[model samples]
Target chain A: MKNMYEILINALQADELIAQVTILNGSNVGEKLLLWPDGRKYGGLGSEKLEKQIIEKAKELFQRQETRKLEFELDEGRISIFIQVYPPSPRMIVVGAVHIAVPLTELGKTMGFRTIVVDARSAFATRERFPHVDEIIVKWPSEALEALHPDEGTYVAILSHDAKFDIPALQVPVQSKAKYVGVLASKHTYSILHEALRENGVSEALLGKVHTPIGIKKLGSRGPEGIAFSVMAEMIAEMRGVEIT
Target chain B: MRDVMENISNWREEGKQIVLATVVKAYGSALRPIGSKMAISSAGDISGSVSGGCVESAVYEEAQSVLANSEPRLVEYGIADETAWSVGLTCGGTIEVFLELLD
Candidate 1:
């Protein structure tokens, strides 16, 4: 038991992403689930079998580094386990750093998110506009997106709101695990642009992730700044699993 | 927790008695994840966390001992440890703790 403690500590110190499941209500009540990278396991929430089974489930979620509380039915009683998945923070890629990019970039920075802004036009994509923004790439979407490595938490917002720019930009980030993909556009523009994506072979499921008119539903008069706030709010809602309801 | 490191070091150099209690490891449902750290000083200053409000009390006691002994130690806590979540990770997850005392 003590050796298990040391091993777990070492793994955490090395920055390994591992889920820690606690049996909140059960006979095993305090048993642990220590699942390693290779799917091998140690410790138990109850018995070896229960631990093994939970570990397998944990590994599946661990790959994505998602957090969820689990409820399990056992022969002896009803069991509930709370699982906290540990994955690295996702990157946020903002296409076209305009006035709206300023607030979005600042918010992302405060929230421990890695933010990137790209623009084909060097004048708009200068470091002066986005001082704290990471990776100011002055290139087309294909060039910039190809260079960026997208993972689960990657968020791409098509702030360009320009067809030629937004269209090309969508191709690179749409397929990635960016849970929140927001494009700044009005309802009419989104309908038109979304159709364009569909025609270009983007699947309905993938296109569904594209948040056109991204952000919380407008509460008052809408403009460029309002649109930026709403879109960022939407991104935050999606990132933290928050819903307006 | 990384945010608290510099402050903790600053206070240590200032000669305030301090101890660091870190969530070195957590099992299933920890309030704070592993690697979360909280530094508590003799003056009752604190920064960061191991669990939510769940485990701070136990951590404080362990921290005080480390401060008194002037030695580092590990405190293992969980629902199964017979302590039964008394001022601990009441979320039922177990956490292995590392404590370092500073002069």
Candidate 2:
């Protein structure tokens, strides 16, 4: 009987992704679910009935490499397994590589988001400034984002603070289902641009998802670091949906 | 247990015979948040996770076994829970655990 931890460490070391499902809260506090890409499965939390149900759920999230917290008590709370699915690390795509992008990229990586900084100007997106970035693309936002296969887990932050660069990056996520979409600008300017999105046929629902006045709160941030931190904070809120206290 | 790798490694440096447990699969919804892990030593010391607190006491027993026998084993919890009031997998999901002795 190979311990679940060893099996997973092997998988991760081999670059083979495996999802480990556990009971975080409620009943069945420590039930286990082992999911594989090849559809091979193992273990049971509590009941055969519940195990089958969780497997079905795990399969769905496994494909997306999504980590989710769920609550269930249909069996009258007998088996409440809060499944936290751990797949692979999610990737983040930044459309602009500028002065602020350098620090932002490094901080993003520290937070575990795979960062890619892109810019049409090679001088700005140089590897020297953004060493932590997994990839540096000297291309337009549309081209770079599309090439990255922007998905629901993808986070695209428009840090150029320029209409030309910001608009294209914003539009890409609007067209695809990028998880987090943010534009660096003031609230007033964002509202005007947001209105334009609706007029341009982008749905109101999607437009609402954009984080304008980017970042959490500009306590006293006036320089590039402040802007970068603000943007990163807002992005963190959007990704985790963490509410302000 | 990527998150707990540092702690496990620290214990390993101390020459602790560590036993690890991880949830490899999940069905419906389970508890303790999947991908959770727990590392235990033959000296009865432990860290990390596999589930919430409810099953830690139970899983520890198995982990201690690993430290003693130096072999891995698969353990199950909840089992399609029956009593809604008990501390079981309320999500109605199932999970499989793969336990290993980290030498």
Candidate 3:
């Protein structure tokens, strides 16, 4: 039991996704089963057959990153197990440290996201500008993203508004497995970017992934702060697999 | 669950028996989502919250019994009936919490 305690602490502190399964209702109530992200199993729920079923179920819920009480009918009887999943904070990569990125990163941190801001201009991407951001890279989007390696948990927002930065920033996430990639631009700017991306060999299918005019439509031209709010909200909706117009 | 790590560790090192109560399932709208946890020490020290203060008192009573007997229990609170008004969730949600002894 103490070993289980140690493992849970270490895994959470290290930001590893793991699940702790506790028998919520059964003769073996309070018995636990722990599962690692790599399919490794530790501890047990006291029955080999029951544990096998839970291992399979854990993987399913683990992917969705949800926690719930699951009831299963085993050879012994009906048992309810509480599956507690702990996933690391999702990564939010802001591709420009502009005025919007300031509030965007602040809101991102408040919402429990690991935020990074990348901009080639050191004057803009300074510690004083983004005090709460986890990382600030003063490299061009092309160079920064190459080392950043955006993955499925990453959410990238291109706010540079310049073709030099926006074009390559948009291109990088489209080629990666990032869940959400948004570009801040007006209709005229979006049209220009669309043509440039097409000329740069970004396929129509990949270009479709970019959310142009990035903030939620209901925001209605409020300014940088409100736009930042809308953009972060849209990013969250995308991360949760929600559909938005 | 992660925020109260230091408190949980200190409680265990002090040889205090502890009970962990976790929100396993929530129906309708809930303030806290499933997997929210609260740890109660034998001396009645609480480090976290399972609810947003709607039912911690009831859970604390339950934790005392769990620590005394080393037994685990699944408890449910909701506004299903007029008598349930004492512990009713104003948000009209039913939260099922699983309580267990943590040695």
Most accurate candidate by lDDT: 3
Pairwise DockQ winner, candidates 2 and 3: 3
RMSD of each: 8.4, 8.8, 3.5
- List model 3 lDDT by residue over A1-245, tens digit each: 45888888898877799999888776888898889868898898889988888889888988888887888998778888888889887889998889999999999987878899999999999999999998999998878987988898899999998987888778788889998989988899999989988998889998898887897887674788899899999998997788897
Best by DockQ: 3
Greater-TM-score candidate between 1 and 2: 1
lDDT of 2 by residue, A36-154 (tens): 86778766676677667777887787777766655555565643354545555556777778787877777787676778888898888888888778889998887887788877668
Q: lDDT of each structure? A: 0.72, 0.70, 0.86
Tell me the tens digit of each residue's lDDT in model 1 across B1-103. 4346556657766778878675656788877766577889887788877776777877887888877777666678888776535665568788877676642
List native contact recovery per candidate, as a fraction of 1.
0.00, 0.05, 0.86
Q: Is the docking of candidate 3 incorrect, acceptable, medium or high quality?
A: medium
Model 2's TM-score against the true structure: 0.59
Q: Point out the higher-scoring one by TM-score: 2 or 3.
A: 3
> Which stretches in model 3 have alpha-carbon errors above 4 Å?
A1-3, A63-66, A72-77, B2-19, B39-53, B60-71, B81-84, B101-103
Q: Give the 10-residue window scoring lowest on summed lDDT in candidate 2 chain A.
A: A78-87
Error of 3 at A237 (Å): 2.6
Looking at model 1, residue A209 earns an lDDT score of: 75
